[model samples]
Target chain A: MIDHFALSQAFGLLFASFEPWLWVVPGLLIGLIFGSIPGLQISMAMAVFLPVTFGMDFLQAMLFLTSIFTGGAYGGGVTAILMNIPGSSSSIATAFDGYPMARQGKHNEALGLGLAASVVGAFVGYVLLLLLINPLAALVLKVGPMEMVVVVLWGLTLIATLNDSSLSKGLLAGFFGLMLSQIGMSTTGVMRTSVGNPHLLDGISVVPAMIGIFAASELLRLRGSAYLVQDEAQRDIAFSRILRGVGETFRYPGVLVRGSLIGAVIGAIPGVGSSVANLVSYGEARRTSRTPEIFGKGAPEGVIAAESANSSSEGGSMTALLALGIPGGAATAVLLAAFSFHNIVGGPSFIRNQTEVVYSIILGNLGQVLLLAVIGLLMLRVLGMVVRVPLAYLVPSVLAMCAWGGYGITGTVAGPLTVAAFAALGWLMRRNDYPVAATVIGLLLGRMMEGELVRTLQISNGQPFNYLFERPMALALFVFMLMVLVGAPLLKALRRRKLQQAGR
Target chain B: MTTRFPATHAALLGVVLAISGFILWSAVSASTSLNNLVVVAPVAAVLGVLLPVILASALRKPAREDVGSGAWGDLLLLAGFSAFCLALTHVGFDVATFVFVWAGVVMSGGRGLWQPPLYAAVFTVVLVKGFGSLFPYPMLTLVF
Candidate 1:
C-alpha cells in the first residue's frame, strides 16, 4: 500500500524547490478572492492566471494551481458561513448551519469554525492522498452510476427531514424543483421543457437560478428584520468570538474526523466532488449526533462537518487527476489543462516517471494550510462586519452582486432576468411554508439523477434484476440508505422514549 | 395563531396541479424515441399521489394560526430587482445596477435615501471596472 521509494522521491521534489514556494501565497490569494465572491470560481481564477504559468516550470505551475485549489476550497465556505448564500454549489450545505449561526450574531464564530475545519480537512486529505492515492482512485472507479443514484438519493432523503414543518409541503417544493431542473436539453438529446426560447434550449442556468433562490430570495424574507441578527443582544460582536469558535472545533473531535474522511473519499470520486461531499457530510453528522434536532438551527458541528468535507474533497479530487489521468471535477479539469501547458501528461506512467512532482504538489498544498489560517483569520474579521449592515442595505447590495454574477454567467440580461423571475417564485414558495432548500437541492441534482437513471436503464437492458443486483457496492449502499431512512428517526424516537421513562 | 382556509388551499393546489399537468404534458412530448420514460413515469406517479392529498387538504375546514410577516415590502423588493434585470437588457449592467440598487435602497423603507444611492454608485463602478475587465466574459455595454 505504501511506496517508500516514491515517498522519498516526493520529499526530494519538495526539497528540490525553493522558487516554486513563492507562487503558493499568490495562488492561494487569487483563489481566496475568487472563491469568496458570489460569482467567481476557482476554475475562473486558474484560467485567468494560466497564461502567467506558461513560462514557469512544471513544479512551479503545480504549486501555484494547488495553492489556488486549497484556498478556493476554504474560501467557498466564507459566504456560506457569513450569509445564507453559498459562494458555489459546494458550500450549499455550509449555509444550512453556518448561516443560521451567523443569524444568531455568531458570524465570527461560524467563520472561525469553518476556517479551522477547512485546515484540518485539507491536512487530512493531503496525508490520505499520500497514503492511499492509488487505492482511493481505484475505489472510486468501482462506484458505478447506480452508486451515484444511491448517493443522490441520500441527498434527496434530506428533503423530507430538511423541513420540519410539513413533509407534504417539502415534497411538493422538491418535486417542483425537480421539474424545473429538466427545463433544458438533456444528455440523451431530447428537450423536456424549453418553453419556446432559444436560450431555454440550454435550460435554466443553475448559477443564476441558485443566486435568486438562495440569496436574493432570502433577502426578501429578511427584509422585515432590521439586521441579519434580529436580536439586539447579539449586535455587539467582536473578533475574539472567532478565536473561541476555532477553539470549539476541537471540542467535537469525532465530527472533525468523520467529516474529513467522508470529504476525502467523496472528493476522490469522479464528477461528484465537494458539491455532494458537503451535503453528504452534513447529513451524516446530523444522522449520528445526539442532538440531531439542533442541526439546521445553527449547530457548530454542522459547520465543521460541511467545511471539513468540502476542504478535504480538494485533496480527494486531485487523487483522480494525478493517479488516473482523469479530471475529477471542473477545477481539476483546469489543472489538467495546466499540466498540458507544462508538457506533463498525467497517468499511471506519469506517476511512475514523475512521482516527485506529485509529492511536491501535495507538500505545497500542506503549506497552504498554514498560510490559509493566517490569511483566513484576517479576512474573517473584515467579513464579520456584515452582521452590522442593515437589512435594507444588505438586500440591495447583495441583489446587485447576484444580478451581476448572474450577468457574469449568462453574459446577457437573461442572467439578471432569471434571478428576478426566481426571486418572485422563491418568495411565494417560502411564504407558502415550503422548504426552499429542498427545491434548491432538487434543482442541483435533478438533471444528474435523470442522466444516471437513463444510463443505468440502458446498461441493464430494461431488466431491473440485472442492474439493481449486479453491483455489490450499489446494493450495499441502497440497503444502507433504506436502513438510514427507516432506522434514524426510529432510533431517535426510541431513545427519547427511554429518556422520558427514566424521568418518570 | 395558525389558520388555514380550505378554499384558498384548494384554489392554490388546483393551480399547482394545472401547472404540473402542463409540465407533465411537455415532458411526455419530450421523451426520447428509446425506452427512457424515466422522468415521465416518476413525475406522473408523484402527481398522481399528490392530487388526492391536495384535494383532501383543500376540502377540509379552515384552520387558524398567527399572521406571517408578508408585507408589500417583499413585493416591492422583488419588483425592484426584476426591474433592474429588465433595465440591464436595454441600458447595460452599469447603469441598470446603479438605478436598481439605488431604487432598492429607497424602497426598502430605509431612513436615509442619499447614502443608499451613493453606495449603489460605488458598487456598480467596482462590479463594472474591477470584475468586468479581468474575466473574458463580456458585460452588456449598450449605454442608453
Candidate 2:
C-alpha cells in the first residue's frame, strides 16, 4: 500500500528548504501558549493564526498548522497537571488524577508522564495514518453518493448520541446546526432562508462562526474569572524530575498503547474527537488495571491513559480530514478551512492524485511530534505563566482579535456579525449544557450531506428506499449507525437496570 | 423533587424550534422539489419532535445554579462585545477597539483610570498597526 516513489518525493518536498522547517518552532510555541491557557483551545489558536498562513506555500502552511496541533496536545496536559483546571475539555481526565498528583507534590512526574505519553500517542497516531491512508483512500474511492449520505448520517448521529448530555439535547444541537447551514442558496440555485440579505447567499462564513463558537463564547463565559489558576505556589517546574517521569511511562507500555489505539479509533469518527477519547481511554485503563483502587488518586497510569488517547486522537481526526475532507471536530474544521484557503480540496481524489503532498503532510507531523517533545520540555516553565494572565485582559483582547480576524476573512460586515451572533448562540448553548461541538460538526457537514442526499435521490429516480438494497456498503453503514445510536444505549440501560435489580 | 422553572432554557428551546420551523417552511415554500427538503425536512421534523421532549425533561429537573458571578454580568459583557463588532464598520477599527478594550478593562474590574486607558491605547495601536499591515484592505482609523 505504501507508495515508495511518492514517499521519496514527500521527503524531498519537506526537506528541500529551511523555509518549511522555520514555522515549526514558532507554531509549537503559539500552540503551547494557547493550549496551556484555561478556556483557550487549540482550534482558537489555529483560527487566529490562519490569516498568517495565507502568505506561505501549502506544505509550509501544513507544517505550521500541524505543529500547532502537535504542541497543543501536550500543552493542555501541562495545566491539567499543575492546576486542577484542564486547559480544554480533552484534558479533563488528565486533571482527575494529575491534580491529585500535583497536590501530593508529584507534579513533575505527572507532567513528565503526560508529556511522554502524548509524544508517543502522537507518534503512533501519525504512524497509523501513514499506514492506513492509502488503503482508506482506495476504500473511500468506491463510495457512491448513497454511501456518502449514510456516512454523514453516521457521523451526525454518533456526535449527537456520544456526548455526556441527554440524547435529545445533543440531537437538538446538531439539528440546529444543520438547519443553520441551510440558510443560503442551495446547490440547485434555489434561495431558501437568506431573508433578503446578499451575504447569506454564500451561507454562514464557517471560520468566523467557528471563532465565535470556540473562542469568543469561552471568553464571554470567563468574564468574571480573576486568573486562570488560583494559587501562585503551583507554578514550579523541575527538568530532571520530568525526565524521570518520561522514562517511567515506558513501564506501563500496555496502558499507553491501548490508550493510543482507542484514541485513534474514536478520533476517526466525526464529532467525537479527543474530548471523548481521553475519557474512554481513562475508563478502560481503570477498568482493566490490576490496582483499580489507585486509579483516581494520583495514579501515573491515569495521566498516561488520558494524555496518550487525547494526543493520538489528533492523528485519528486528521485521518478523516485527509481521507474524506470531513472535519472530525473544531480543530479539524479549522484545518478544513485552511485547505479551502489554499484552494485545495481534500478527499479521496486529492489523496489519490496528490499522493506526495499527502505523504509530506503526514511525514511533517512525525517530525512535529519529535519537536513537540523538545519544545514542550523547554517551554513548560514559560507556559505555566499563561494560567496567571488575568482573564479580564485576556478576554477583550482575544475578542478584538476575533473581530479583526473575522473582518480579515470576509472583508465585509457579515464576518464580524456572524462572529457576534454565533458567539451569543454558542454561549447560550454552553450555558444550557448543549453540546456546541455537535452543532459545529453539523454545520460543517450539512451542505455536503444535503448534496449527497440530493444526488442519491436523483440517481435512484425518487425510489431512494429501494436503492439501498443494491448498495450493500450504504446499507451496512446505515445499520451500523442505527446500532450505535440506539443499540449501545439500550444495552447500557439494560445492564444498569439488571445491576439495580440484583442490588434490590 | 423541588424544581425551579428555567425561563431562559425554555425560551432558548422555543427559539431553536421556531428557527427550525422557519427554515423548513422556507425550504418547502422555495420549491416543492425533493432536493429542497431532502435533508432539512427530516432533520427539522426530528428536531421539532425532540425539542419538546427535552423541554419536558428540563421542566421536571431542578435548574442548575448559575456558574458565573451573575448571568447579568456575562450578558453585559456579551452586549459590549456585540457593540464592538457592530461598531467596527460604523466607527473606525481603532476607535471602536480602543473604546471596547478600555471599557472592558474597567468593567472587568480594573481599579484605576490611567492604567486602563494606557493599556487599552497600547493594545489598540499594536493590534491595529499589526493587523492593518497584514490585511489587504484599508481600514478606517482615527489614530494610526
The numbered model that scores best in DockQ is 2
Q: After superposition, how far is residue B13 of candidate 2 from its true place, in Å?
A: 3.3
Candidate 2 stretches with Cα past 4 Å from truth are: A1-118, A129-134, A162-167, A231-365, A380-384, A479-504, B1-7, B54-69, B136-138
Q: Can you tell me which runs of candidate 1 are displaced by over 4 Å?
A: A231-233, A488-504, B1-3, B6-19, B32-35, B51-55, B58-70, B142-144
TM-scores for all candidates: the values are: 0.93, 0.71
User: Candidate 2's residue-wise lDDT over B1-144, tens digit each?
Assistant: 223645557667877977888888988999988788877888888887887788678778766663445767778888999999999988889999999998888887776869889989999988877656656566777767
Report the lDDT tens digits of candidate 2 across residue range A1-504: 789999999999989888888899999998887676544468878887998999999989988988888887777788667644455657767876886686565777788898899999999988988998756544544668887777556545434432436778877887888888898888788899887889889788766776677567767777777754445554356688789889999999999999998788667766656766786687667655677667556889999999999999898889879998988788888899999999999998988899999999999999999988898888865654444567678678778878886787678888888888888888888788786666766776688788888889888998889999889878987887677557866887799899999999
Q: Can you list each candidate's DockQ?
A: 0.51, 0.56
Kindly list the per-residue Cα lDDT of model 1 for residues A217-244, writing each as its tens digit: 8888887778888887786556688899
Best by TM-score: 1
Chain A only: give the TM-score of model 2: 0.63
Worst 10 residues of 1 chain A by lDDT: A425-434
* Deviation from native of the Cα of residue A136 in model 1, angstroms: 1.4
Which residue pairs does candidate 1 place in steric collision? B1-B65, B1-B66, B2-B64, B2-B65, B2-B66, B3-B63, B3-B64, B3-B65, B4-B63
Q: Local error of candidate 2 at A226, Å?
A: 1.8
Which pairs of residues have clashing backbones in candidate 2?
none
Give the true-contact fraction for every prediction, in order.
0.50, 0.67
Candidate 1, residue A454: Cα displacement in angstroms equals 0.9
Per-residue error (Å), model 2, residue A320: 11
